[model samples]
Target: MTTQNRNVEIEERHVEKKTDSSMVASTFIKYTAYIIIFFGALYFLVRYVFPMF
Candidate 1:
């Protein structure tokens, strides 16, 4: 019984770690996408949109 309980605890910890890692990866991807879009928009404005005035 004690051994089974230990195994369960270990499995739970592993799952928790995996979930944390996935969350971090997703957050990083989201931020990177946002940054790229922001820079792209800024560049476009400076190169083409701004000159129209």
Candidate 2:
């Protein structure tokens, strides 16, 4: 048995970037809903949950 080193060349194909409109809109909507829910919870906490201190 003999040990040998070999070199290999790789070829890459160019790919086109595509954007999905519905995906972008849904992501934006999801983030907006998260912000609204966070603020709403914070408001509720301040209004009713923290007064017992």
Highest lDDT scorer: 2
Measured by TM-score, the strongest candidate is: 2
Where model 1 places Cα greater than 4 Å from the true spot, the runs are: 1-19
Compared with the true structure, all predictions reach lDDT values of 0.85, 0.97
| Candidate 2 lDDT, 1-53, residue by residue in tens | 99889888899999999999999999999999999999999999999999978
User: What TM-score, computed on C-alpha atoms, does each candidate reach?
Assistant: 0.61, 0.67
Report residue 25 deviation for candidate 2 (angstroms). 0.3
Candidate 1's residue-wise lDDT over 1-53, tens digit each?
Answer: 35443433444444443358888999999999999999999999999999999
**Whole-model alpha-carbon lDDT for candidate 2:** 0.97
lDDT of 2 at 39: 100
What's the number of clashes in each of the models? 0, 0
Report model 2's TM-score to 2 decimal places.
0.67
What lDDT is obtained when candidate 1 is compared to the true structure?
Answer: 0.85
